[model samples]
Target: MGQQTRAHLTGRKIYGCGRCGTHLTTVEALLSKRFTGKFGQATLFYSVVNVLEGPPEDRRMTTGLHTVVDLRCLKCETYLGWKYIKSFEQSEKYKENCFLLERALLQTIEPGLELEGAEDPISREGNDSSTASNLQEEDDDDDDDDGDDEDE
Candidate 1:
C-alpha cells in the first residue's frame, strides 16, 4: 500500500451507487467502493500530530494519538486514498488534561479514469492533429515531385 500526500475524489459519488444503490456513508462501504473502482483507490496514512504547545521537537511532548487509512485494490492491492485521525491536549495547565480529538481528515488520489489499451484525450488529440499535418505535408511533397517530373 503506497502513501500519497494529496487527496482525490474523482470517481467518488457523493450519493449512493447507481448499480446496487448502496449508501456510501460507512467506512466498509467506502472501502468496497474503492475496491470496486467506484470511488477510486488511495492510500491513507498517519503523518503526525500537532499540539498547541508546539511540535514535539520544540521541547513539547508529542504524545498525541494518530490514525491512518490505506486505500488499496482488493484484487491487485493498488494504493489509492488516505485517511487520518488526530488528537491533541485541550489545555496546558491541566497535568492530566486530555480529550478525544473531534476532528477527522481525509485524502484521496485519483489517477484519472483509465481505459485499457486506450490513450488519454490529450494524447489522442495531439496524435490525431500530428497525423493530419504529416499527411498534408506528404501530399505537398508528392505534388512538388509531379511538377518536377513534368519540367524534366
Candidate 2:
C-alpha cells in the first residue's frame, strides 16, 4: 500500500491589535460565524496589514501573506490585519477571505482608528493639555517677534 499521510485541516487564525495588543478573538469569532455561509460567493478582498505569527526567520523572511495593506511603524512593528488564502483549487489559483465589519463592529475591533474617543493612550496624550500648553506658549513667543517676519 502507498504510504498513508495525515492531512491538516486549514482554518482561520485570529490576531491581536498591534498598538494595544488587544485580542481579536471575539471579532474573529463573530466574523467566522457571519462568513460561514458566504464563502466563495463574492469578491471580498480588502486592505489590511499582515501580522506575522512569529519573528522573521531570515533576512528575506518578510511576512508572506497575500496582500499587506500597510507597513506599520518600525519602532513598533505590529501587524494590523491581512487577507488570507481560503482555498486552492488550481495550481496557480486560490480563493481568499476577508472580514467586512460594520462601522460599529470595526470600531469595536479597532476602535482607536475607527471611532471617536477610541484612540490609544500615546496618541491621546500626544495632543493632551501638557503638549498643547507648550505649543501655545511657543506660538505666543513667536508672535512677539513681529519684526523678524518683516525682515524675512
Candidate 3:
C-alpha cells in the first residue's frame, strides 16, 4: 500500500487519537455529545480528518437502523468510531454523513495542554528548578564580590 498522508486539524479545541495523538477533528466540527458507542459515551461530528472508513454495514441503533462504516485512525489504524452512511428512519436522516467518535477513545489536544500517558512539561520544570536556583545564587555571589572590591 502507498504511504497515507494524515490530515492536520487546526482550532482552539482539537480532538485526536487517544493512543497515537493523530489529529481527528475540531470543536467547530462537533455536532453533539449525546451519543453512545461500543465503549460507552460518544460524540457526533459534522466532519473529521485523518480517518479511514471500513465497509458499510447495517446496524440497529437506539433510534433506528443505520448504515455505517467503522472509522479508524489513519496513522495508527486504531478503531475510533463510525460514520453514518444512510439512515432507514426518516427521523434519523439528519445523522447521515455524520461521524460518531467515542469520547473514551479520543484525546483532546490544545496548546500547553498535558495529554494523558504523555510526559508533562510542568513536572519536568519542577525537577530542574533547584539547579536553576543554584545557578542564580552563584551569580548573586559574584555581584557581592564586586561590592567588596569597590569598598577596598
Candidate 4:
C-alpha cells in the first residue's frame, strides 16, 4: 500500500489497503523497485515500515539474493510486499533499511483533513484503475541489492 505521484495525478498523496492504512509507518516511506529474482523479478515494490525479525525460514537461494522478508497487511494478511532485513552487497548495505512496495497494490489517501461525513478515499481495485496501472516506480535503490528474505 503506497503512493507515488504520476503526471496526471500530480501532488496527490495515496495509500493502499484501506483496512491496513493504520499499520502504515509513514506516508513518505522510501520506495525501491528492483528485479532481484529472489522475490520475483517482475519488479518488487514496497515501502519501508520498520525493522523486523529476520525469521529463520526461506533463507537460501540464488547468489546475490537480497535477504528480504515478506510484509503483509497486519490485519487482513494481504501480501503488500517485502522489507529489507539485510543486504548482500557491502557498498549498498544501506538498502537494508527500506521497504519496496508494490505500486499496483497501493491506493491514495487524501493529503489533508477529510470533508465531513466523507469516508476516507480508497483507490479503485488494481485491476480496474487505469490511473493506478499507469503509476510507475520512481525511486531507485542505492544499488547494493535490496533486503528481506521471505518466511511464512
Candidate 5:
C-alpha cells in the first residue's frame, strides 16, 4: 500500500517505525476495529507485502483461519507488528485485510529528499545544513563588510 486516504481521514497519515523513520502503511486501509492484547492498542489494515503467519518452527504459514502474520520494517527488518489472516468476527473468514499495528506511529511527508535507511530526511534548504548555514553566515559577513566600507 503506497498512499491510502479515507473520506473521514483527510491527511491523517499514520505511520510505524518512528525511531527508524520508516514508512510502512497508512490508516486508511484499516479493516477491523482497534483492539489490545499481546500488542498494544492496534488495528489491522491491508498490505501489499507478502503477509504470512506461523511460528518460527512452522514457517510454512498461510492465510488460513486464525493465523497470525508478522509485520516487519521493509528497510531495517525490525518487528513492527502482526496481522490477522482472518477477521476477529467468527462469521467472517479470510475476507478482511487485517495487518496489526504493534507500534503504529504518525509520520509527515517531509519536504525534502527521500533516502532509504535515513533516520532524518535531508532538509529542503540543502542536503548539507552545515554548508548552508556556513554560506548564510558568510553572506552576513559580506553585509558587515559593506557597512564598514560605507563608514570609511
Candidate 6:
C-alpha cells in the first residue's frame, strides 16, 4: 500500500464530520451561522473539503425555490448538509455556490489534534456500502421535510 493523501485544514478551529471527525472546513470558510437545516441550525460557508455532492434537487424553501445538492462526508458518508446551486430569487443569489453545513452534524476539531480515522486509507476510498447504509438511515428521515426555512 502507498501513503494515503489527506486534506487537513490548518486553522485555529476546524469543523469536521460529527460522526467521523474528517476535516470539512475551517473558520476562515465560514460565512454565516443564521441558516437552518433539516436538523435545525446550519452554517453557511464559502467552501468545504472532503465532501461528496449528491444530485441536485429543486426544493421550495422559505426564501424561494432553489436547486441544491446534498453534501455527504467522503470518509463516512454522513449527511452534513447541502450546497446551493441555483437560486431563483434575485435577492437570494448570494447563496448560490455556497455550502450549508448542519451544525448538528459537525464536530469542532481543535488545532494540533489529529483527525479520527485519518490513518485508515480504506475509509477515504469510500467503498464500504454497508457502513454508509447504517450511518445514513437516521438522516433519511429528514428527507421528507423538503420545505426548509429560509437562510438569514
- Candidates' TM-scores? 0.19, 0.22, 0.73, 0.50, 0.46, 0.74
Q: What residue runs in model 1 are displaced by over 4 Å at the alpha carbon?
A: 1-65, 89-152
Weakest 10 consecutive residues of candidate 2 by summed lDDT: 34-43
What would the per-residue lDDT of candidate 4 be over residues 46-149, giving only the tens digit for each residue? 44332233343334434344576766654445565566576665654655645655544444444452322223224434443332343333223233334544
Q: Which stretches of candidate 5 lie over 4 Å from their true place?
A: 1-14, 48-65, 86-89, 92-96, 104-152
* Tens-digit per-residue lDDT, 1-152, candidate 6: 66445588888567778777799988777776667888777778888999989999999998999999999998778899999999999989988999998876776666666876443322445553423333245333433333434563
Preferred candidate (lDDT higher): 4 or 6? 6
lDDT of 1: 0.24
Q: Write candidate 1's Cα lDDT for 113-145 as tens digits.
A: 222222222234444244224323433332322
- TM-score winner between 1 and 4, please give it: 4
Worst 10 residues of 4 by lDDT: 4-13
Candidate RMSDs in Å, in order, are 23.5, 20.9, 19.8, 9.0, 19.5, 9.1
Query: What lDDT, from 0 to 1, does candidate 3 have?
Result: 0.69
Please say which candidate is ahead in TM-score: 1 or 3: 3
Error of 2 at 81 (Å): 3.2
lDDT of 6: 0.75
* Superposition error at 58 for model 4 (Å): 5.6
Whose lDDT is greatest here?
6
Error of 6 at 76 (Å): 0.4
Go through the candidates in order and give the clash count of each.
12, 1, 0, 19, 1, 0
Off by over 4 Å in 6: 1-5, 117-152
The stretch of ten residues in a row with the least summed lDDT in candidate 5 is 143-152
Compared with the true structure, all predictions reach lDDT values of: 0.24, 0.27, 0.69, 0.42, 0.40, 0.75
